[model samples]
Target chain A: METYFSAELTDFKTLYNVLKAITFKEYATLRPMEEGLKVTIEEMKCVETSAYIPVQMFESYYVRPQEDVKFKLSLKILTETLFIYGDDGNLSLKMTYKGPGFPLCLIIKHNDENITVDCQIYTMDVDESTDFLCLADECTLNKVVVNANQFLDILTDLDNTSDDLDLFLSPNPPYFRISTTSTMGESQTDISKNSEMVLLFQCENEFQAKYSFNYIKQILKVMNFANKVSISTGETGLLGLQLLINEDAKQMYVEYYITSMFEDDR
Target chain B: MRFRALLVDNAAMKDLLSTVNSLSKLSKDCVMRIVSRKVYFIIPDEDTGPRKPLAWCELPVNFYFKEFNLDGVSQEYNEIYLCFATAMLAKSLSTVKQNAKSLKIKLTNKQTPCLTLEIELASNEGLQNRQLVHDIPVEIIARKNWNDFAEPQFNDFHVSIEMPHLKPIKNIVERMKNMSHSLIVSANNFGRLSLQIKTNMVNLSAHFTNLGIQSFAVGQDNESTVGDGSANESIVTATIDIKKFLMFLTGMQLNHCRTTCSIVHGKMVKLASEQVGALSLQCFFTELSN
Candidate 1:
């Protein structure tokens, strides 16, 4: 099935800010003929998620979709205000999307409320939409598909990571400690929870590789609905994050891996 | 017993002693007495002394200390207040008495139907030696330079006297004067003031207390002609809490003066000393009479 989804960066940033606090990393896949993007955030370790905007109701006002509105449109909003919509109405909130740029689109939904935010993303024009879809009767899915260039733009500008651990765990057998450092960028940066970071380490085989901090942060970010996380490691430093995506169902597990970038010497 | 580190520095030892005496007027609980002298060592006798002497004395040693208390972070600093008083008194006395005709000055108003400075510094025994002295109301003299000092003379402030071989008091006075930078620190009502002073560079500050010193401008946007540099000096500021000092400043209604502290960048600098880095001064207005 070939489906297309599109939205704005402002929409995604609003959604990211709202849900990022609830989930480790948001998972969105494009489904042909679907109304918009489908974002599923795993729920397990609430502590893993750094972004958490609560769901609420609001006073009057309604949004109408323009029939002639252009599809596949992307725009960067640089205003300080972040717009959020509740079950009742749309209102501004205290949040800012900071990375390399201003416009971002990755909206998530819960109940009748929908959320998105704007992060200035820098990328040469590219396409990343996939026709992958999931069907569920009880669970709620929220998403916004914005221009791929806007998302790629943000990825390209981020030449450095944006987080640090107070200290490193001792390196046993396969795991070797690399440099544990922080940022000293030129411009005064607004330290945001949504900032992208890369965690590096050297290890033995595929199973021995320690989980990257980014992967852990991402999982903890999206699957915050659960209380605990069970981690399993395998061949060549491959860390498996086993998470409970739903509350009532404990048997269900969503998994992902930290791909070898080969860019890091360790 | 944890004590506050009080460092007082002035040009004359007599002046330093007098300041210590002034504090006695405020509170009698804290007292300053000489503990040791230049190479002279006064050991306690096995005999519990025919009579217990109050002040320890001799040539070469001079420091008077007192306990300082705030909410309750007792430091028990060593040679703290005494070092200050000693330096100041040495400087003050060095200025007036050059050749040393016995001079008398009152240090404290005590019914010393008792203790004498000489008895304490000299013998570990009997009513040591005595010299009758009159209290001369010394006029407050304005010093033109910071290094100016006077010689030590017997003051009527309940003190004892003794003449013995002593090192050049001038060398000692000069050393104490140079060491004065470590005693005075710049702090405020909430916390200790902190700043990093570069080598040989004088950092000038005019705080809120010195607001009335319109003649000495600080924090102005204009470049100060005092040194050659771009007017735009980088300033790093941190927040501090100095509630005790604030209460004292407010209660006293003092017009703090502007101060400039810098290192004497020469070959003979003591790198290991604690006063090497940033030194700050909180200058308060003394009686004006040049």
Candidate 2:
């Protein structure tokens, strides 16, 4: 069979670290395009996360002309393979995939120690049932961009037992207010638009929604590595999070979208 | 039958203590088969499943002890086999190994069959020396089951090579363990070693080249097995339990010029060191069911 995709790259630990953030799920979808590669993992169809790796990340990349290649694989197994050599050494990676029914082949080289690894991970046909989430046309929108660490700090302070979290966003005194109730009591945290941590604020309309705190907390690992976070809410209450990660001045992006939990409306 | 020994040399005590420590990591129950020449530590088959011996180690009696004495059952049968808990022996040895002027071991009948360990600790200051005694119960094995504890014999190997640094191999095996239960260990005459793990989802392997082939020292009926060029080029593979292999790598720490691994095709593997300082060390791992 002809090779559909092949790429040679060094510094694979960056990609490994990025995939680890979304490993709460076992299988993930990998799509190789001319622009770059995209990894998508979702939790119970309620939350969705995707990571994009650009073509520049590889030293050399090739794809059979006009071939749309996508496959499903175990994310945990792939990450463990990438990290098989360990973290201390500088490992160069060569990845390849043929057409359908072929395993993803990875050749890892540790030149400093004169050791090499060959990994072949069988790929499965992608399940097309996943519905890509986006902001609907008729929904009201409230977008807030803030320092990732500061937003994460506020999230960490919230009560872990609270299942439902109320998010209120507007152009009011408290631009963003997060409140939740538990057996202990009710807790509320407010972040104003005037705060120095707020990098960008845009309000198309007022948006209020209740989200499952567990889904929001699951992707905190991605946020911890982000320099800035873009949070937007839709009228029907779809929470969208975009993380901007800057390492050694190279920018990377991680995106998440979670549907709000409305008891009576659902 | 009577068996007793005394160890006073600090270096010999340390060697015996180190070997006991390794044995403790191996198994709980141990059989001390004493003859006039040497002592053997035999690890019997765990359950009633099969009769394959788990491990067998030899310790020369006169080399490790200052005073060695043994009285066998009869003139024809000149060996005594006694079973004891290995952890208890290692515990006693480690406690008295340091600062003890002399350590004595003797078989005594204290209520049950007990092996008494008397330690004479040398005092550093002007104070008088202290003595500590520990009675470890043992089971005297009858001659009927003597065939079960036979020594493992060396045989022809398809591939024999010096093992690489174990630290890296251990690290990689640990990672692979999370992915699969068993792994494939293969080596070629081209001086290459590879470990592989295969699952329904993935097949991952690590390869190391430029290793030196090991030949056993002469005088043990160990003749060269490599016949032709084609025979030398072929690869020998073994599918073994990753847990047992990892246990061997971590626990078997013998000081030698190099650790040699000899594989008998898909049957078994033998890891041995010609000289562990003054002691000889060897062990075997049987193949796992596919």
Candidate 3:
């Protein structure tokens, strides 16, 4: 049990805010690998989300030889603890995990105040990851890429009482349509193929799927930090939403898989 | 009893108002004791359940106000004690803090005993002088209960050290409050202060060193001095309620005054600061036995 891991990051604000946006759950599983760290959060085994932070994001990254180095931690606590360094100024962060059953330690150095914070956060047993049907291959029936900010605007216009969201995709007329129905009446937002927001529209056949409005709204949390978002649907009604958080040298990705509700189920 | 004062300086009035506003966050009501030329606001220890620490604030009557007058209970005892809702007074002061040229505070006996504040605002556009009056009702505590508000004394402290920059401490303590209910503060006479929180899940500690140690006053014995060849080099430690400590930190965020924190091992923690000729704020936190 003599394993040691340490990593350093220069600008913590970007990484801190990105992790905070997806902290809707209490516990998240953190898997530290040689390449980087992978954090996965799930809700009721129905909606699973993961963020892949590659090694290039850290100023200095290292991992000793270890097998199955995964632990469960409270996302809420981790996010709150990181923000204590504040948003302004250049904050340098050094994180370490001594070994198995040892708490994860974070040392934050604030440049302006010449202050350092050493925080030890407890870790729990890692839960098995939820395996969702793969929709990355030819099984992806429909895929569309849109500007994240524009999609957020469309989501904000939705009626508060709407329960179901219907997404339509086509290769020709009315390239994309997102409509919601509730007692307040029906609201629909349509985007044409020639619109600037629609970056890519690839539809093998005209496909449509129905997903819970509340589940789809979760994407709004990450919309501000993401530049572009890609939405795709599988033949088995699995919706994949990928957000491009940063386009700099250290690219980050936050992806969500929401199990869609079929038309007949409603 | 008759009490009246006039404040002419806007900056002094604003500072006094903001300090009172911060004090109001600690408790809803407090006793304002007025002596001949000094004013004291005291919040005694609440004995209803667990120990609630006391707060004592003193201000010179002539510092912020230009004209002052006072009529106490009697000539021999030249002091007046009145219990007033701090929130109400702070609200009235905040409303007229900006435009008021002069503020007059008086004790009035109307439908109810009230502390009347008359704010005279600068005229806008050839209009008549504008005045706004707010009557904040208060309860005059009888002389029998006056003995309860005496200043607390904790003479024997293990370590007394000046605090570091408040901005960083405030940021860390605010987060600690969210994680745990009690905070453990430990300091050594060698200029090292540690803020820690421990629970079944996690134990977190922040160590700050190279702080200035305030010299003990003359004739005061200095025991528990670090690096003095003492057998036990244990740090002076006390666990205090995190909420109260955070409130003190929040109040310090607004003022430029320096703060000194003194801790009695496993006994109590006292925080004291004063602005020359203006006001002083002191808070006491009784240690919680583990």
Candidate 4:
């Protein structure tokens, strides 16, 4: 028999810290390809989040190029198993999978002791992932990059009772504005082009769309772990958010796709 | 049935209140027994339905109080046992924890027998002295019910070891609690401890070595009988409910004190801690049969 796959990492927590941000779903599908491993989670067909950790991010990476390895496992068990190392900076990890019927094995070594974990997760047949069309010619509306910390602060100040979040983008002054209305009052936050937090802004035309605040709040889960975030809206009311994990050469990305709630639906 | 105590040290009183508050996290009602110079808090586990764990805590009366006097029911029965609501006492103590100058505890005979905490607050500018009194009702237990709250003694322990820093162990236990309902804790005589949890999805274990082994005088007599056998290398393991074990670790308030753990193979586990002022806390966990 051939060796299925095996990979090693020097700083095991880097992968753990990113996967923890998307644990709102119990089961996540893991797809190992030539480029990297994509961990995907979908909720109620309305929102989908994925964290991509490239092969270069691992110290030692190996995989059978011809074979396709895709499996679904419990995210809670995976996260808890990785956290057993207890935030030690000098730990090493080795993960392996044998074949279709074998279990996923993780070996963590710290100091002189080693912990071996065997997870017998039942794998289900892979399902086609929902495709959120991002064609440049058909659906590009607005794109902006903002500091993750500043964006989190603005979202925290918004009234939580409000159900809808209105995003206004224009080429004129006050390039970006986020407003919400509830029975209590209406709160609006305006960000000009000159603000230090707004690193890049591009808009083809004036656009306004209302999205469910509950769906947008999912982005806040990863705000503390990310340094910068890019937000974009398309003509079909599809929202895209990309979070940059670290600024160094070995960076990872966590992306979210959210479907907006239109005015006529209310 | 007369008792009164005066606590003059603000820091020590705060520590006492905090320890009581932590104990309240485990159970809502407990029996507090006071003799001439010592006090003990005991909770007996119930045998039916869900497992109600037991706890025993002891502290020297002079450790936190400046002046203390007590007269029990009689000479033979020198101890007084009172059943009180731990939550009510914790709530009352928390209100005066920050700025109280002195605290006086007295047994009062109101409409109901009550333990009254009279707190004297510090005087502020252009304001007079402030005083706050909170009465917590209690029922004095008769001497017949005192046998249910006796000190626990463990005679047949396979291994007695001083645990490593509790912060790391606590972290591991907290994570294991999320995966399974019970946890398996095993330790050997060679200063190694391991925690394991097994479920259908995963089997996880963490090992800590190079720990300090506490040599107790009781274990010395059994040392020669097992001469060169596997008793020296065998591992003593106990499986316990994760939530109950977690509560015991967090409620002891042993952040700065030394903790020693003893395991009775397939039977029970006992943990003890002693501070500088003759204050000691002990917790026991019974094994759950597989």
Candidate 5:
């Protein structure tokens, strides 16, 4: 299922950054999808949502045969600003969210382009929507879900606590472990004795989907509302995001339960 | 017995002295050492027993305040309301994974055996600490919105009666109704009383067993000298205690009546023999008529 939404490009950049860091491999087809440098997207933060694509993105730059068409929405990102080229070159779209505890829209530079745009943005509450899409242009390689404490160990190894770190992290740990190993042969001439590689998993699934801690953490770095973020993988091999809504309300603060579904590909 | 008689004059002071003597001599008794204490007669009246004829003299009083601080902030005051410097030691120790601090509450008047009014004050950046937290009755009353709140209406019946054979029927119906808003049946010498109270309503009745109480001839049998001193009166004419009337009529134990009265006649008299009994009966009918 898919949904579509219209949101400024800037708001989606950080979200795009987060989504990109978790994807192992992805291919974008210009024929199936429109080729556009600048597009607006709205994503679902919750289960219930209304989705639409921004007219400014789909109408001009993206060469598509269809008009007034909508698609399934995936996620919504709230960022400060996004810039793209119009017929006039160098156009900017601003993103903003309105809430009591939400962060204000921030202006970020795409590149060294001395271009800025002024625009108003209104962030909708996260709800399920069928007509929206949240995508990252880049892709990810290896993803391993580890306990927050264990992940802390991993981050300590990286020691890359730079301001420009594009990593995301969540407190969720995977329930299973998967590893691939290959056996070496003693004699090359023995054709009958063939060597094989085996992959063992703590939990088996028909689809294979994993997430990097850095990616999840970055998307929720400033989120004080939810406690856990759920990670799910789809058949397309893309990581699906679902935030666990906490039911235990006795707590003074809000918390989210995040679960990531390992793909079953058996 | 002699001490009991002395206690009749100064019970609280006697209790204080007994406590001081019970403690070890080595331990300093701060209460006993307090050279000054102040006593105030907020209201002076001769009816309370004896007349002072003058104001109470101010005496020297000494007290001490102890503070327990964890961070030099959130200071807790202990034994501040005491009129003596109590010699009690309170110690607390804890081990934390990381260095942390917390305040502990301890009472210092272990030997004084006095109840203290404790107050906690804090600066408020939020609503919780906005108001001062104190155990003082006046402070507590100040915190409540008694002015805007409505007081619950009470259903009451006042009764009075003067009969020799029947026991005094206090407005027990009204008292019982006040205690529990419901109908009740009571039996005694003069008559049987039925009381029913519903929310803001009340119903009461008295049915005499023999030709009713008013028809029964009541006359002085030249009983005794302790009568009301009226020659023509039969039943002793003693003032009825309205409070006691409610007590007895409500089926509350007769011994529980706080008010006292002189016995001029027989204990066989019904509750209707008292002034409050008659008055409460009148009130019951008046209320029913209204």
Candidate 6:
């Protein structure tokens, strides 16, 4: 079988965990480039998430580049297939996509048992636009960097029923604040720019934006494993988050872009 | 009925507390039967209790209590049976594992039938000890209904094998539980055990070998309670609810215990703990709901 794109990973957990976090949707588009593999999943066409896996992350990565090898597969089934051995023994994964119409073949080898499991996940043509909303690239107005775990702890108290989550970034007192009001009552969290948890703070202008609480809640699924989060906003009230996911000292990036809701929507 | 027990030994107190804590996960309520020699925690298995099979545990009264006294309805049946919520009992003994200098458990009639647990706390100041009391209401079972709380019976099992320490399999089963509701667990007399789960999407199985196998000769009275495998090299398997199986592994609190997993071939699966001087816990999971 001629392989268009193939990558060997010594451990499956690295890829499995990253995919599991972004698995809000059934299918996600995967693009294999010279640099690495990019997996993107979009919701409602307004909110999008992309995970960048560099070539260095793989034990061996090969690509023939048959006119930009790209396909979409079920993220739910793919993540489940990665850990088929069920948390026991050492597992190595060999993933291959053979040109077009061929299923993404995953060969998982149980290192301890000397057994191998072969899975063929049917790939489909990408129907959604592969474009990722990079908020930090242009129309940027504010930025705030904080430890993801700490931020996640603060966000846990947010009432999910709250329709909108307000974000305010300023150079004044309580430089970064997140406030929400719902049936459970109003709750607000304030963090100063000088706080030790804030790694980097850049706010050229006082900016305020509101996002759907449901969309903001999606980050919590993956934020626990992320080391740090870079929060950025555009002039048009677009919010962007670049999460630095550290596992076994290896760094991976997952970017999330959320379109701010109109203030009158609430 | 009158019953009071004083537990002063810290090690025994912790053991008793651990047993109760483990039993708390098996059922909402359990029968606490008190005798002169032993204190039995019984959740009698009934046909109605199919989803969650009953658990039976025996803790020697001499090991836990410094003073053990009980008066039943008659001298012939010198035992008291009390039905209480396991969570409440576990909550009352939760502190006993930590700073319990002494624990006195007595049946009290202060406006209600309750088992008042009075625990003497060890103070860091080295001054007078502080005290904590918890009143947990219990239903005193009548003597005529005592048959309902009898010890569970494991009649016929096909293969019995000694299972490895559950701490290692805890995460493995937890993850497999997500894949399927029923996990087929099988073992043979040749020291081989396997856990397999079959679903519409995937068929996955893990095999563990070179383990000790229980001999059927050990089953003198209760044929399958101590585990029995009369056949050799023949695999006997039973399908068990994956969640309940995980519970059995997680609820084991006693340390350095040998667990025997016996399967009755599509009928039932039993996990019985064996530790000399330590309380024995037998967990039963009926076959095939999924």
In terms of TM-score, the best-performing candidate is 3
**Model 4, range A1-266, lDDT digits (tens) per residue?**
76566788777566787788788888887777778877888888767788878888887777788987877778888888788646755677777867666666777766433333333444454565545333333335788999999988999889999998998888996789999999989999999877999889998688788888988887787777888888887887777788888846788888887777757855
TM-score of chain B of each: 0.21, 0.87, 0.90, 0.89, 0.18, 0.88
Candidate 4 residue B253 C-alpha distance from true site, Å: 2.7
When candidate 5 is compared with the true two-chain complex, its DockQ is 0.00
Report the Cα lDDT for residue A252, model 2. 70
Q: Candidate 3, which segments miss by more than 4 Å at Cα?
A: A1-4, A129-139, A262-266, B45-53, B95-101, B122-124, B130-132, B215-233
Model 3 lDDT tens row, B147-169 = 77767777777778887877778
What are the TM-scores, per candidate, against the unseen true structure?
A: 0.19, 0.85, 0.90, 0.76, 0.17, 0.68
DockQ of 6: 0.11
- Deviating ranges (above 4 Å) for candidate 5: A1-130, A133-175, A178-203, A206-217, A220-226, A245-266, B1-290
TM-score, first chain, each model? 0.29, 0.93, 0.90, 0.88, 0.25, 0.93
Could you give candidate 2's per-residue lDDT for residues A1-266 as a string of tens digits? 77989999887767788888779899998888898887888778778888878788878998887987889899999888888876657778999998799999999988877788999999998876664434333233767899999998989889999988888887876778899989989999988888989999988566788899988898788788888998887656788888887766566778888899875653
Predicted candidate 6 versus true structure: per-residue lDDT over B199-226, tens digit per residue: 6544556666778876543333323332
Best by lDDT: 2
lDDT at B17, model 1: 42
TM-score-superior candidate, 1 or 3: 3
Q: A79-184 in candidate 3: lDDT tens per residue?
A: 8788874555778888898877888898887777667778888988764544433435623778888898988888888887999998888887888888899999
Question: What is candidate 3's TM-score for chain A?
Answer: 0.90
Q: Would you list the clashing residue pairs of candidate 2?
A: none
Off by over 4 Å in 4: A1-3, A10-17, A44-47, A83-94, A107-217, A223-241, A258-266, B6-12, B46-53, B62-68, B91-104, B118-134, B215-233
Task: Tell me the fnat of candidate 3.
Answer: 0.57
After superposition, candidate 1 runs with Cα above 4 Å error? A1-83, A86-206, A227-236, A247-256, A260-266, B1-290
Expressed as tens digits, the lDDT of each residue in B1-290 for candidate 2 is 88899989877777778777877787898898889888888776574365656667778777888898888888798899999999999898886655888889898898998989998888877868989899999999899888778787756776788888766777788789999988788887678888999988899999988899764233223233455755534567778778767766666665553677788767778776555436665667777776
